[model samples]
Target chain A: MIHSDLIRRLPASMKLAAALAVVLLVTAACGGGSSSGGGDTAGAAGLEGKTVNFVGYGKDNPWGAYFNGVFVPKLESQGVKVVDLTTMDPGTAVTNFNQAISNKPDLIVAALLDTSSTVVPIKKAKQAGIPVLVFDGRPDPSVDADVMQVLSDSEALGTAAAQNLVEGLKAQGRNSGNLIAITGTKSGFAAQDRMKGFDAELAKTPEYKVVDIQDGNWDPTLSGKIATQLFAKYGCSGIQGAYGMADYQALPIVAAAKQAGCPVGGKTGLVVTGSNCFKVGIDAIKAGTLYGTATEDPGTIAEQTADYVIRYFNQQNPPAKELVKEERVTAENVAQFAEQCSKA
Target chain B: MNVMSAPPRSDAPIRRPGRSRSRAELVIDAVLLLAVLAAIVLALTTHRFATVANAKAILTSASLVGIAALGLTLITIGGSAVSLAISPSVAAVGMIFLSAQSFGLVPALALAVLCGILITGVQGAIVGYAAANPVVLTIAASFAITGIATGVSGGSTVSPTGGGYDRLNATPGGVALSVYVLIGLALIVQWTLRRTGFGRSLYLIGENRRAARAAGLPVGRTTAVAWLAAGALFAVTAAFTAAFNTSANVNLGGTLTFDAIAAVLAGGTPIAGGRGSALRTLAGAVLIAAASDILLLRGSSTGVQILVKGVIVLVVVVLVHLRTEGSRA
Candidate 1:
């Protein structure tokens, strides 16, 4: 909020610059190893003719939709020929990496699943003198050091959502309630970190007791089923709040909350918050059915990740890690976030 | 009685529903009985497990797996090795179902089923006509289909929206719609296995391909038809699966394919090929759901759940093997 507030205070030209800086932050977190921005963009404009190879984890899932349908297209539209190498888990990442090294493009960007299997391929790419930008999951130093390791601040996202829920709980004149955490896949890094961040924040406040944490596997249907199960067990009046790992996970919880005879949003509804703002989540916020969600902003992340590298190539000076601005969207400010949420 | 109420009208070389009494059968039966008892104990001991909501969940969860198992049941009964591709094939069907939502669900569903039949029938032709190994071919086919489905959907989840197909996932009269669909389909499969002339051909071909071929039976044609039937079964199952999740998930079919194989084999179908029963597969599916539900209620992880399921399968296989060995002794 302070970040956006600062942007609001700045002049229009500076505001756009600050916004682009947020995208620069995306590259810094995962791979664009450095985070320093506001460097000389004098030669950055020369990147228009170069080709970039994107090796994304795109095996027929929603996240893949964003990567393939949204993120990749946005990059190619920047006048660069993009070779899309999207594959699923279980050796697909390895195959894509192998292909990238074979092609030896100007730049390589990827979203990886397992770091262990990719160490060899990534090292080979480095040996071939190609710079790699990785977003999504972080690569262990054992994997690569020279790469850009930009990732979403899932911990911050989770913390914000938790703070938003606690705010709702306080508005209802209480500090503690039976809150549930509907998590993503039990084994996924993103879900694990988000829950960790949530727990860390909630631990400071003793009143908001997390009664149960169920794994939703990041599926809305599974989330709905788990919510119903919790409702059936605790009844409508028993549970007070829910923190969904993703909006897709949280949206259905809202309906189930209602079906369980509990209101949603405002001071009355079970305070519900989700990370990764989807259109459904934004709509829920507008309808006052959901409390908050973090702006994942894949499009911005991809664009900035590529844009920053181009700037570096032009000036031969890498930017430091930049933090992509993720504001927790509540009903009071959901209108501002609506257009961004609509992109994917 | 219907298990015994069958006579071959084609002067079939092999009987469709004949059983050689073996102690392995009894042992596997005991193991299944033990699993049921374990679930009952959990239900009685836990308030949540015994609740109506939990009961419905168990039934609905099993329904999806059991429906797909029904098709695999036919394929195995027809002597095709378990098609690893069944899951991916069904997943593609789910994607197709999601894409065709604007044109009306029923029509889309029929079209999807027809396509599934064609794809599966091709697998059958490869195995039957080319004499390609069923296991290898179907595994390859599964990968190919999954790859294509992933490409078409562009890695996006096509979830069902609006009230147009709400009844698909509705739980009517305290029973999930999927449960009814499972029962109806299971009954149809059972009937097909018992009453149809094509049904007897499956047993003959599976019993001895050379013998059936010598008898002038259309081996390739029967194999393709069997695959077509199984494909139809899988197409309907995929629709329910998509409806269950409210989205077309590419990974939806992966877990169920093996679970369905386990269910059919544990339900009373022999691995070497001879006998199969839809009722048994349903029981196996129920057992799996009940076991998984109780374990899940106890807060088990997905890895643990998978381990438990694998253990049950291993136990059944081992018990069957030991009994067969002891009988020979």
Candidate 2:
């Protein structure tokens, strides 16, 4: 009541100016609150007209395709102009990242091929007062340059793969048998973590011995070759189950096994499981050639990464590190993930 | 100086002093004998190395590299040095095949081969007519091919819409179709190298380009034909690889160039050219494959396999160098 009376007593011009000032103050308060509250579309206004530089890797592979397909469009839809510096080569990726830092965009988003190679440039970006958002690979915990990171639970995915393998074996009416692990390049962090998790989980089941572990190098052709050699070395009856680090790798094993005259996928046949929930794996699962697979869907991780980017810009302060959840997909639950996996 | 009269000797059978050729052949034979003895020792020592399944595995794995090496042998013989573009070309052709599969299998395969021909044909024309460095030209071609493939495919894996071509992966009579293809191609290529005028011209041109040019030989054309033949074989390798994987990507056959080169070198083909055979490349591919399989069976790491292959290449290179030096002396 007092505020209204004061306005009424003022001259007409003074009253108009005072009312305008109050309106502007209220608008500012609302916008600030909305941005801080982490409202989905609320903070997008802040990103308008800003530029982001994206340094990525493996633009040719499925995981990279899915992530780039989703993430770039989302940011662009909010009026964020993106500069793409994606490359498949590790050395080239570092050069691109440094170039991105020099561009000094409003933000720097990167998915480095190797963290060790980019630590120096990331520090430079930090010193420049530019925020960095990392995805696909987590930076070293000691590094303070990265504002936040969104990564797949690769170790958990590996554990899920082991669980699926065991379940597939049980479903095939076997409690004890020999198994082979066809993994990606042994030096890769993802491959190593997956194997570590696989070993930790498989240790609980002592009867199932890992007779051999060969590096497939994440190559389908090499994996197929390794599968053939493994089949020859182990014989059709000697091994009962197999684990492929990815669905593409697992599918080749299925083909190789068929060529080797080894029965696969039936109750009495060999049990095969893969990870990475690729469409090929989903299709094979539907076709009954693949026993099971674990979900490390690139699309899901990408979406979360996008959300974190939005949150960061809005000053909502997303967590320093986020590990996306992973699950195992088998015949029983394959239908639920079929659509997403197909997209991946 | 009558160009034709300057080298009447060029038309009378292109020979390399006879002794050097025979010594090289003898060294190749010794290498083959050593490979055989090693295989026998592995079979006796290893538990499952002697099985038919194991033999099939080795041959099946070797066939891919064997086919590519066979074509590479022609290039090496024609004095073009080695091509570093084989892997990229194979990958590009595989992508082309998968993309064109909607128009029946044979048409897609033909299109793929034509694309491969066009790709290497340009490189051949440059190397043959312009006398460009084969290694540098092929390296540049690899970059261009990889870039184009990535852009055209949008850096995604290409999968066939239909399954009609899966029969290409079939094993007939307990032998892989790829092995049969490799053997058939090797025989045809070997026969052509022995009987054709083009083959004789290649040998003459490779041994002494100046003499062949003075005698009015088609040096440039023969070199180009060698490259074209290699491209066609590379296309065949791509087809089999894509059919086996049921998908094609830019990374397809990533290690193929190195493997193919290794096969050519191990086959006892002199890098200086003028002599070699497709059958030798096949044998070399088989030996390498068998060695890899044996190592794998014995639980060796990939590093060890690579190290052993490096050692084999080093030994073969040194042995060839010694023989050539000895013969010259």
Candidate 3:
């Protein structure tokens, strides 16, 4: 009876084994091995052959695409191999970091979507002896030893943007009017800092009293939808100025303003300022669609991040703990910076 | 529509060996298989989809979903409905374990399983006691579990770092482990359904609770047990997901609730319950995964994918319902 039962199960067992073998073979054949290739600059010293993992929030976003296509190539010319791992959502970021850590990659370049949530993991990466590079977002002090934060000065960016908006509004003969602050996410580093800086600057200009401050969560669709309600509820007659955290988030809002037939850009228009220096944002600036924005060249971040990773590999003290620069872009200087700022 | 009320007729052929399968059954399976096959072919034609790597990615996603689908299969069989919280629960469990065990894979897995069972059991008991609408009950449970996950992980991602990432990314080998676990679950479910009196009691209860109780079957106990079994399966599949993904986010199991229900329906399992098997459900999951991969490779946006998924599910459900009607005729 036992022998017969065993014989009866043989085909099923064989089929399972065969299926497993197929999976294994495929995995092996595809070079799905643990990233064993260490940090090696075969030809160029900075980043030619190295795989710099970029862990960020949304890889599908156009901004993410620019980083991969345009920015990473710029890094490549600087000798760095950029492996875009930006799909590490709120759920997978830690595991992604761990994967990079296990692979013992030369360096980890990450964007902490929520500064608070990513602190522990960044600190853990630091503990694992992996040098970290942070961009577009701030890092908590707890993970300072392990990280080199490269961020745009939100205060400077915000102040400069506010100044530009002030000048634009003044040019329009509405020197100061009711201003509304539209932020993508209310709690994040960039959002919070930008809002605070904008508020402080606007406060100095006593004529501009902040009328409304609402969070649009950095979504274009949501911002546009909200802009409609804000217009109706807050009365755009006195709403002479608008500040948005990012261009992508601001795009729809601008579209809504135009739909409402509100004045935009040229002399007597709704003065606005946004960040991220996205190509679309620059295009808007060039077309007198909006005021100016604080620009952090994304390509520079990728290149510098790659170099920092290589420096860690070489056991050289990784570049300064923080690489921040105040590069504000306005309509006046935008023409000169458009070539470098443009991202296809 | 009233398969349960339809009296057993002498003219009907039993589903035993030597009896050729019905034409309707063949048609249903053919249609389902064709859809799956078409997806694979489409994916193959697309360069990005044809690679061994992308294939593994699809399978990895499928396996995590399949594991949860198995639990859903059980709940479905038991006549209990649930929501997408299975993924979040899995994430919570994985994160709990990962956080506690210093990246110890086995312990984290065990904890995740335990948490899945306990949470599901609590939800099942409430469902059984109140006999509330499964849809509302599951939605409520989803929120509660999601809240707890957020609280536990503090809205932070709990992922396996260092060597943990390797074991998590071990696609073929890791996937086999999940598949085996699923097969094991299927075998146990099949055995319970066939050999154990409890299984029959559960099925009878699902078919007609009052009749089963009147017939001296322990209907309530069996129903609860069925739910409990589903809970166990849900947790196990969840662990497999965390293992495969190498991390669990607060929203890890969010997608499974809908996918599992859809898979159960597509696999010839009546939403009203009392019909289906783990094997059929697994096939449904594969079909769904295959379809998704195809659409994604075709440059379909997330919107298109969602629409297609809903349509496929509805079509499959309608076809299955039609098959049963035809079978009766």
Candidate 4:
């Protein structure tokens, strides 16, 4: 009787629309929330009393932790009130951006979580004349007018890593063979952009063919699994070079390949390289196993981001884009990064 | 040993509830036989299926899931559905293990296990003393542990600084220490299940809580102790997992809850509870690993692997439910 009365109270169309409206309203309410109250700093015009809102992605990630621990403190030392806001997903990123715009903080910095879902809200923030800072991802161009992006140059890093691997391969006196690449999540900006630069560098050498590029998902186990399969398919002698999108991903592939009787490095046979130069990878390079790796320090990225926000707060028109330097580290220069090896 | 074929007496006072032991044993034997036959098929056709390295890899992976599942199995056998808290709890303990490496690897690993025990023990106490729903309490515990873990590390992966972790990762004589740990834990769980007063009380509470209470049994204490033991087992799993990966991420236990539940149910444990064995779980672990290996060997994608796992779990649940109903008739 209750079900019949409820059904009779409203048409199906009205019920559907009412339910949808409730869902959207609930989503908007839940999407963006303040994660931490970072306390205030004291000073006049030195960013003391100035509020900087950082709209972040999920906290359970490398970027989230780096931005929180490293970036937040950097902002506070200059005497600023920092509100670190976070979202669970891309939709939440958009919602948080809108919530952030309503607050109208002196400046807004965010890690772009998605290409499509986050663009419109970020554009809305810009239309409202709130200066926006972004890192790690690029949104649509029309929406990019008031947004300043600060991130690593993926292409240059990839090219440098590729150059190291190709040269290592040539040192082995191997002219013709297939080179396999393991990338991060295929949909991620890093994978697509870095692969573009890597493929271009590989193309410069006509003898080495880019045979297969598989998605390692930036997970060590998945990368290792894919490595074993590739080794089985290509055999030890047929494959010449290997590239991993990150040091963590590379470590497992190297381990699996070794267990499968496929030796790597110049001394053994294959040329292997990793990016995001982790301490372990540096050790591998020094041990003459890894050919090279590219370093894009997370702390450095956080520093650049904080500097950009502070500059915008200091009044003058700041640049729309800021990119940090990426260094290619190999056995020759591995000693240079030894002091910061354990930072990762 | 032959609970299935033992002489049946009409006036038996301590018979296992629901289906007769023989029928349940029959179903389990068929499932295990199929698992073994499948492995034999793969060893005959797949190139590396029988190799020591591949076998070690499969066992190492299985052993982690197996240890966690064994802990959850106590909860399931004791009449609760399953602990949703385990996967996140494992990840939290792994982080603890990595951070506590300042005190040396063994001491740090022991601390991590203690953390797991305390967390789940608290949950079990709440469920026992307050008579709270175990599933709901465990779900809350999962969130609590994950939140704590995320706060501790700021949600990033961490690795121990000391170079001695590699020793834990090493497999002596081509067989991983993880496999031996699994076997030992399974044996311990079996002994506890059959040879202890608390174990029998758990069976009674699972069968009928009201009856257990009326019979002057300490139901709440027994339940709490079982959960506490289960928690320790879960932490041990996390410890070995940290050793295996040499790093711990927030999502390190990805797909583990699903796999554990599947392995438990597919291993012939009834969802209705009351009668199940730790020995059954060992066979379940082998079946799950063999199934996954065979699928991967045949180049099955993630979707296909999941599909097969789902179907197998479904077939098992249906068979158990029908068998239970048939016995009631």
By TM-score, the best candidate is 2
Assess every candidate by TM-score. 0.79, 0.87, 0.46, 0.78
Chain A, model 1: TM: 0.79
Q: List DockQ for all candidates.
A: 0.24, 0.38, 0.02, 0.17
Give a tens-digit lDDT track for model 1, residues A1-344.
99878767889998788779988677444544421221222334555666677888664656656645655665567666788887767497888887776665777778777776788887877766676778776665686575776677778887887898898899888757889888987666778778888889998898888888887877665566567667666666778999888877776677566544567776666888987877667766877778888887666566666666566556556544444666788877889989877544
Q: Among these predicted structures, which one has the highest DockQ? A: 2
**Candidate 3: which pairs clash?**
A47-A79, A47-A80, A48-A79, A48-A80, A98-B161, A184-A217, A184-A218, B87-B253, B88-B253
Given candidate 3, what's the lDDT at residue A66?
48
Best by lDDT: 2
> Which model, 2 or 4, shows the larger DockQ?
2
How accurate is chain B of model 2, given as a TM-score from 0 to 1?
0.89
Global Cα lDDT for candidate 2: 0.81
**DockQ, cand. 1:** 0.24
What's the CA error at residue B163 for candidate 2, in Å?
0.8
Score chain A of model 3 by TM-score against the reference chain A: 0.78
- Fnat across every predicted model, in order: 0.28, 0.46, 0.00, 0.17
User: How would you encode candidate 4's per-residue C-alpha lDDT over A1-344 as one tens digit per residue?
Assistant: 99879878998898999889999888756643432222111123357778877887667765466556778888899987777787646777777777777676776778877766777777666565666778765656666765778877888778877888878877778767688888887787877888888878878987888777777777665565566556655667767888888877776666556645667786557788888766667767887878888877576777778887777666544577876788888788889875444355
Which ranking of candidates, highest DockQ first? Answer: 2, 1, 4, 3
Error of 2 at B66 (Å): 1.0
In angstroms, give how far residue A149 of model 1 lies from its true place: 2.5
What number of clashing residue pairs does each candidate have, in the order they appear?
A: 25, 0, 9, 0
Chain B vs. true chain B: TM-score per candidate: 0.85, 0.89, 0.79, 0.86
